[model samples]
Target: MTKIFEMPLYPYTRTADQDAAAPVRHTAMIVGAGPVGLAAAIDLAEQGVPVVVLDDNDRVSFGSRAICFAKRQLEILDRLGCGQPMVDKGVVWNLGKVFFGDRRVYDFNLLPEEGHHRPAFINLQQYHLEDRLVARVRDLQRQGAEIELRGGNRVQAVDDLGDRVRLGIDTPEGPYTVETDWLIACDGAGSPIRSMLDLDFVGRVFEDNFLIADVVMEAEFPTERWFWFDPPFNPGQSALLHKQPDGVWRIDLQLGWDIDKEEEKTPERVIPRLRQMLGDEVAFELEWVSIYTFQCRRMERFRHNRVIFAGDSAHQVSPFGARGANSGIQDADNLAWKLGLVIQGRAPEGLLDSYDAERIAAADENILNSTRSTDFITPKSEISRLFRDAVLDLSEHYDFARPLVNSGRLSLPSVYDGSPLNADDALEGGPARTRPGAPCPDAPAGEGYLLDRLGGAFTILTLDAEAPERVSEAGIDAARVALSAGDDPTGALAERYLGAARSAIYLIRPDQHVAGRWPAYDEARIRAAIRRATGQE
Candidate 1:
């Protein structure tokens, strides 16, 4: 029998600072300990920045939420030292099948081409993920990462004073006031900080609701995503099936807005629907259940002076794409390096503004894709349904129409094209896959991967070339590595980074995004690009 996993609750201990005569200030304060806030804390602590993380709860998430972990999100988690465990414990699947009215319309594979480090996606319960992250923070704490997690502590007020932000925290022991150079709000969709400031979360709220249930059962279902538009068992609505770790299955049933939300969650009402989809012979135990409405919305900006918003606190999307947690992790990835640099005084505070512009663009992309997926899944009008059916029908035989079929376009990493931080590359003929402003494509580097070798600081990657004798110091931790033909035996690195016998040098940012690349190494250009990437130029 496969055993279910549960995380032990972290104890809420009163800190000396809470018992002090006056409120204690922290260098960085993070609100919430969900995946997003925890990611921020872990990333900052890994960079040796002291972080104080406050969470209103003392236990991991109760449900098997946010099951799909994208490859890019895994990479980000890998940097924080928790990705491998997730991959080890998760159910890895990249194939997805779409069906329409008992007819299989289309199927897709996420990782068609290879040489990447992580799989395209993994299915792990949100609780399990949070548990692993909490354990990782403990490990980092042992390593002298000054990170303090105060569970049962909630933020009641936030004041964005120039140069610093003040937070009024309410703890089980008592209430305390503290100030920080930066305050990152990773509280959920209902962000109290957002509410305190009266910031507008602008976007559309679709009139469709989805019922998600996690069931424990021994079944022969393949470990792949199966999506249905008007399934035969449950007509006029969509259904989704995904295999999660620990013999659990996540089922999503599209319930129109008019349905009674409370009554639908009861097992008496939900079991019959499950029996209709699965046979009565299949015995199962209910694990967790939730009903949620779709909303694709975001704040006007992610950053406000000394206070920054990340994760669901900044934007929200429908669950169809699995963009919420994945994008939230990316938000932490984008912010951590910039915040670390600013805190170290190596980069100007304007570097933090670039994080806002870039992540806001990512949020916009997520919202757009989620909105489109919602529209296709639950058409609002007869004409919309007609077009959706037509597209689904045509997708059965045609490849072009398959792209039109939106049963939730699975999450992918957003590229920061035309970002102010991206330096204009002089070399246009190199590999188009690793273009300027694109996340550095991972390739086989010595024993591990390119991303593992290049993150956490500015790195200059030279292919088929030697480092220039004279390198300029732009006041950032910069390292240079040259890969000779012998070092790259597979030629995969050259193919992904340098194309067609081309030799080049790439300036990779701390976040592992390409700042700029040149056909040949130029010391001055490299320094200038680094300065520009850091917002110093």
Candidate 2:
């Protein structure tokens, strides 16, 4: 059967740069047309910056690699103009159940609150996500966005020329040279560009393997995450299950350190395991199968002058938390706006440093959480195993111990505490969740949502306060979004923005992160905050 991912979405085509007298330099060029690269391209294009994306392959990824997309990622996608389709095709869930052996430990709700438009998580195959991102690029192209996706364009060599990056690309036709003022590498974990630059990852790689299988079947399993520790089917090991868009079910079975990965991936060995997990009567077809070792590592720095790395090229985490692609998308979200500002001369080059600082912090947070989850899932020593088992046992009956059971501290948006771009919190008694350097929590605003109106540029959100229609500081304009408690019948706006203060104002970054907040609309303070957010202060 022919699937969307199997067809050539962006076939190789010759470009004028191949025959140019000199390499044509672009404002921004992204390597690898996967989710992160495509997202960065779309974001830069939307911000009026021209971008070109190059990929070695013309089709989407082969397997259902990353199946979990978090809510914050969905919000970023919404701002990128392709969130609805993803949500429509994804299987949404918030509840997750943890098990010890054959006994159920405890269940959890990731999104316990309301007012947010998206759910806690969505389970969709990576190919489907890439296909949608490609479609979005097409839509942007139709709308005259200066974005290009060149498939079959493999970068052979890279030269970092202080001010620009020179790349030797190998296409189906031949090789060509091109230049870019800025280069964004969104290549996979085993990044060729990283190797070309002689960069290496610094972190730990656990000595444990997990077999991932995407199986298609008609089953009655609920649409929720189910994780089993030391299950009878896979004794002394762990397993995970979740439903996908189609009848496909993603199953992960832990295999200890000493097993032959190739032998375990074979259908002869995999089919019997499936029969044991699901009764012998259940019929299913294997769609994709792979074995992966738990790795938690990242590059020392995401940016090296003109060439920058995003996505897996920057960092990697164990798949249990679904932080890989989600964090990579966040890398795109953080870099695009800063890069656009720098290219347009609206902000200084130092603004790009914030990307390094912010994303590195995010990457470290993910790696830390991922390492802890790996330790909990695959405890190294016998004492560690005993402690983990005792914690799991105690979690079944006690509510307090439930927090100790780490089935992967699920991915969440990183709060950039103490960021250089953040202005001092001036709003007295405001909610901590919406403080400077934190992603804005969505709330009901009129007919739509708060985030839908806050992104794409600097914004001054006035809650029961008066602000100007627009405020410009150092060539950056921040529009005003005025709303009152009456806008949201639920009073969530007031609760989130104005906890104890009667009126408040929030300065929002282009990526929907809060830059500053105040109790009144002071133009001088707003200008200072705008400058700080843009790295001009």
Candidate 3:
């Protein structure tokens, strides 16, 4: 039998409430110490905002939950100061193969070309990611970043005033109430705070179940995602295989709604099923098993008065596309900068509304993709299954039907197309890939990557033309480069940013979203764009 992972318990500490102390007020308080909450604390502290994080549990997650981390999420982690270690400890891959019955239908590469720093996807356990973020938070605390992480503490009640929030926290010693200018809830889907406020999570719940098992074995399988529909061993069912760190393999088997959940997870039942797929003689040990039913749901709004919601508390999606945790990290990234500015009184309160707008749009997009993937994988009616099998059969021969296959569209950064913060499309005949409302694409910049040079605050990217001295006088960060015609070294930055002939200038937000772009540097227009991006206009 494979040894189960043993997590150390975090000791509960005495708080000021146990003693006769006055109520301590904070600039911001974050509830839940999951990946999203830890990330939010780090981002806010890095921006010079004092933060306090509280969680009921002390250690990281227990199992290999939420393993697939996308490149965009890795970039966000890098900005928070812990991406490199996660990448070093993760299994990186870009290729996936889909099989129809016994024959290979098609194979595709996510990132065919590689001039970037991070890979398309990395398979690291969610616990490892949370540990790294927690460590980063501690490191920042030693460096004078005012971040206090209190474990074994849960928020029993929350009272939201017009301009501040009051949290009644329960600890081992006693209960105490503290006030904060703002409250961020990173609790999971069954959030008590959401329930206390009587907020309803609205969406569709699929009636299908999927069994996931982690096995420790020495196998010769390549580092690629292998998926099968109606394999010989498990007829009329779908199976997925993925490689993870530390000689572990994740196998997901589709189970219909009629099966008993508890009986299916037993080793006696699971080992036989695995043996049917892998040869009977192959040696392996079952590490963990879980049964899950897919759901695509989200709250109507993320922001509620002085209290805000993030991560699973705000939205949720099926695991098919690996969108749940990745999108949650993006949500924290989007809200941190805006919340920091609001706490510092640098912007108006209306700025918080934009977070609600953009993240709701992103949640809708994720839910739509996840629902489509679940439907294709677990078809409801006979007509749906017929069409799915037809597409898979034709994909083996015809290239046209290959795109019709829906085996988890895979997570990609969403573009906020209708964001009120973006400038109107002004420049014609330039690179539309990095257009307004899109995340800044990574490109070779000097010895590093483009995204590495463009975060933490507002920046202006000027390429191929001389930046006027008056540009900096406008009080905005500018990365100016005047490249010669034949001096195209990496040959990617200019092409991706489309700054070939004349000067191309782009105003970037703190979260690295492109606010506006112009062909020439205009100090007046750039400042105006900055105001619009920050909700100051």
Candidate 4:
């Protein structure tokens, strides 16, 4: 079935902040109650913004939507005060093993990162994380902030008139209308939001399809991922094996282009193939199996007008690197605080436009990196397949060849370099090369209060030995400061982060990346940036 959409952009500020009073009397409406929408609503409510969140489903169910949460995603979840609980529930994995034809090809360990003590990655099902987030968001309601969750409510139409977004929702009660200052869509890959906007979701769809099955297996496959190359039963095809919680395992079997989708993917046929692809006597109980034909498309723009797109509504990557929902949540993290700032009369309207600039950069980078991963995983050309086999076959003997043989790429954080909203001197070379305003190094200070204790909105880390009152005088949130050097820049803190990075004040955005850094407190620049980042100026 084909979908058609039409979005109208009424005149609004294109490159400037509008003078306003009382924030134009706004409420926010969010479409889709998934992680991305929930995260966005949670961030907004915490900032004292009134929000109405709608979803077609009323409750949570465990399904395979997203599987991995990178370090960055965890940090954003921490802002909502739920990441620690998530960490407690899921196992942190710093080690990953790659195998080809029953032989180990490559292994990676990620503990050597500058600031983080925990592993860089965690393996938890998406719905489990969603379950945790929903609880955290509810906890905010006790403090007089509320998220009106309209379960079983589907957004049918959106009219983005410049000043307000008019929404038509179909609900169990009946059709209703919602008027909001902004509308955020988190409606997944086949987003009704995107379809209603008439925007092109442009990208190449992969010809090769894969059968994904979540099952319970008696075989004790190690926790690390296993990759098989050209198994005897499925010659010239590969499969992936990874374990999940509750003794379940996720298996991905490559489907040939010519194979009949329904006949070959049935439960009866999948078992024999599983036994052949994964050895006999495995005694694996099949749970759920589905065929996924992936595409590498991205929407032309994240925001068309009053309606803003997030998660699968913004972009869809070939699920090779597990960057889909995780990236979407980050987009919410970035956009929420800015929206709150604008709605609360803290920032100017121009700040909202930056949401488009920053997230588009994020989406573009995700697509490029995920595209590379897709190419590496599904070797399309004959030459690429031969080379992949050669590398895997040779990895055992050659010490230097091990890293080269790995099919996976180290997931690099998307950088916001070219964004006009980024500070001109934010990184400017030297030791701060992880993008202009990347997350600062995490260091442990033993007095029961560490850097980990300072998450929730933008964090201003004061590194000045003197405890300067400059930031406070400039009307910045000084109590929001995490005093890095209380008495002196102690060894405990210095050794954890790079020594030279001490004595610098870091202005971290709500997404936890450094928005700007200064050698000492500069009242004028920081105040301007705070206003800019929050849309206050």
Candidate 5:
């Protein structure tokens, strides 16, 4: 394979023979058009950088894999302009019910005490989310964003050209080559890109297998998620049933005893188990049924050479908390700006180093969180099962275990200050130190904008009253960037929301995270921070 960068992208001159060559150069070439891959393409295009996305699948998927979206994921999608439509189509659950056998033990509301600024997480099928994202990417492509979608094309191999990257793509017509500035692989867990780079994924595979059944039922069930710790129908297994969009329900039956993987996936076995769990009174039509085993793995590194991994290509979680696509989208959001900046010559190529470090940190945390969740729910060993039962038994009386019972650790935003791109200890001073390198916290701003106004684009906020004018004098673009002055923010939000400080300036990334902020206003610091946030510096 030719090196990705040195290779010519577009045809300089056409050949007259039967075998001809056409070269078209792109700013970036992305592998896999799943939700994560397409999201990266759209984000890069939104930044005025040209992109080409290729996928082997000819159409969208019908079977739903991931069924929930966390608040942080929703915030990231909302910035991409897809959150509202998804929220409109998907069901939002504020509470979930956990059953200790036939008895209804407790009901938990996710964002119970937190105000309306941050509501509960959403439950939407992975397919619906992808469909909406695909539509948006198609629309963006139509607007001449240079985002090319070749659905039937597959990436055969990628070679780093030092200054650029080259790709050899296989299509039904024949083989074609694309040379681009950088390469991002959003392919799945068994990623060809990750394989080509020889990155080892380190983690464990759980022994338990889950029988997943997607069915459409006529009966009315609770809107909240219902999880049976150990139902009478399956003594050693867990049974769960949740409401999906348009009367569709998802039921999972833990296959306690081993069976032939091929023979058990049929609806005949899955239906019998469902009837056993819910009894004969529940009538339903099983739309799809499959067997799934959990795998918790993360690559030692997310980036190798010029080929960077996103989505499942970098890491995979047990889907206990719907962290699979959620983390992948987060990965795309983080890399989009950095890639654009490096491609546009606004920032050094070293900025791309953060893509691996920050995302890996997030992926590691997600794997740990999700794996812990799946393990706790589906304990493998007999002793572990006894401990789990003891914990659930203790929940009956112990008030101290309530926090453990209501563990919401998976829903929190990941911290990324550990990355090389983040210089929290730099000369920018204190206020910049406050933001760190994590998802920007949602604080209620004035007017109709509120928390919604802070995302989807670059923003500069001044709590000092004098910093706004000082930043404006630094030649910041006002059209795409919003300037806000928090002279006397509400006391309710003063300490917890926005900190009380002077001459403080915050530059928020497109992903709605505080990329960099400073307590003191310096022209070089402001421009550099804004450039770094927008992928310009």
Candidate 6:
């Protein structure tokens, strides 16, 4: 039977730009139609920004490359109009178990709170994700969105002009030239665009490697994440197990530094390891296998003039925390709205700089967490190994030591603390979680969720606070969404948004991050905050 990812969803078709007398210019052009690039393109197009995506291949990625998608990323996808399909086709899980030697040390739940729409994490193959994102692009195009996905269009060279970028592309038909006001690179780790511009990543690469095997098997294991430390199956190393859609299961076995990677990937080498772990009773077949090293690295800056790098092009981290694709999607979420506003002349070009600041900070956080997880999983010396073992042993009984065990800290949304766009926290008694620089937590509103009404534009959310229906500043409109405590039956809105204050108002950015909050609406302060959030101040 034919599979979704096996089909060429976006086959090559020659465009008129190939026959143009000169290079055709586009508002935005994204390289590499992976999850990040497709997401950015969809975001910009939804905001009425014209975008074109170029990719060397026509089909989705092979294998279950990245299986875990976190909750925050699911919310972002909801805003993009494609979250439900992914969640429906994914294995939702929040419970995770950590094992020391042969016994379970501790178990944790990622999302224990209620009133949230999405789960803590979902396990779906990378190919399925790409397939859904491409479906979204088709939906947007049907709705008259100005978005294009050009498969088999590989960029051969990039010339970053001061005001714009010129690209030399190669297609099955032939070679052509084009120009873009802004160029976004979502290419994989070996970013050709990054290389063409003479850039490099800076960080640590661990000496150990891990074998990833996507096994097709029928098993009764519950939907949960399982991590092992120095288990008897693969002694003195780590192992991870995750369930994916269909009958596929993702397994990771830690192989020490000095092993033959090529030989380790063969069935002769991989089957025996799996038999030791799963036992002879369980029937399984290897679907895909690969070996990877732990590397925590990122570019010094994500932005370089008109050429902006995102996703793996800008940063990379160990696969432990599921930070790779999740963070990359966040990069798209951060860049699209700012780039849209800049292109529309509603915000200054400086607003794009905040993308570099916020996402770089996020990348740093992911890298740090990944580095720590790798260190705990594969200790450097005898002292470190002893410390890890001690923590694991104590965690089985003592609650105090459980926090010390790090089986991949797991992915979390980064709070943009000290961001230049943040306004003063005038809501003195407001909840700390919804501070000026924090991403707004989801809560139950009147009928649906609060986040559903918050994105795509600046919003003024009023809770028992009277405010105008709309406020316009410098040609940008900030709409008002008024709700009282009675609107939420669960009191979540009051708890998440207005903790101590009886009445509150919030200014939300297009990307749904909090810009400012106040006890009452003041026109002057709101205008000033709008200016600051848009880089006008």
Backbone clash count for every predicted candidate, in the order shown: 0, 0, 0, 7, 14, 0
RMSD each, Å: 1.8, 0.8, 2.2, 7.4, 6.3, 0.8
Per-residue error (Å), model 3, residue 9: 7.4
Model 2 stretches with alpha carbons more than 4 Å out: none
Give one digit per residue, the lDDT tens place, for model 6 in 1-537: 997778999999999999999999999999999999999999999999999999999999988898899999999999999999999999999999999999999999999989998999999999999999999999999999999999999999999889999999999999999999999999999999999999999999999999999999999988999999999999999999999999999999999999999999999999999999999999999989999999999999999999999999999999999999999999999899999999999989999999999999999999999999999999999999999999999999999999999999999888999999999889978999999878888888888998887867899999999999999997689999999988988988898899999999999988888999999999999999999999999
Runs in model 4 lying further than 4 Å from the true structure: 1-26, 113-117, 399-406, 410-412, 424-430, 433-435, 447-451, 467-502, 535-537
Off by over 4 Å in 3: 1-5, 17-20, 468-488, 499-501
Clashing pairs in 1: none
The TM-score measured for candidate 3 stands at 0.95
TM-score, candidate number 6: 0.99
lDDT per prediction?
Answer: 0.88, 0.94, 0.85, 0.68, 0.69, 0.94
Q: How many angstroms is residue 450 displaced in model 3 relative to the true structure, after the best TM-score fit?
A: 1.1
Total residue pair clashes for candidate 2: 0
Angstrom error at residue 280, model 6:
1.3
Q: Between which residue pairs do clashes occur in model 2?
A: none
Off by over 4 Å in 1: 1-8, 468-472, 485-490
Error of 2 at 348 (Å): 0.3
lDDT-wise, the better of 1 and 3 is 1
Give the TM-scores of the predictions, in the order they appear: 0.97, 0.99, 0.95, 0.87, 0.87, 0.99
Instruction: Order the numbered candidates by lDDT, best leading.
Output: 6, 2, 1, 3, 5, 4
Name the lDDT of candidate 5: 0.69
Over 4 Å off in model 5, which ranges? 1-23, 114-118, 406-409, 423-434, 449-451, 469-495, 499-504, 516-537
Candidates 4 and 5: which is better by lDDT? 5
Cα error of candidate 6 at position 315, Å: 0.6
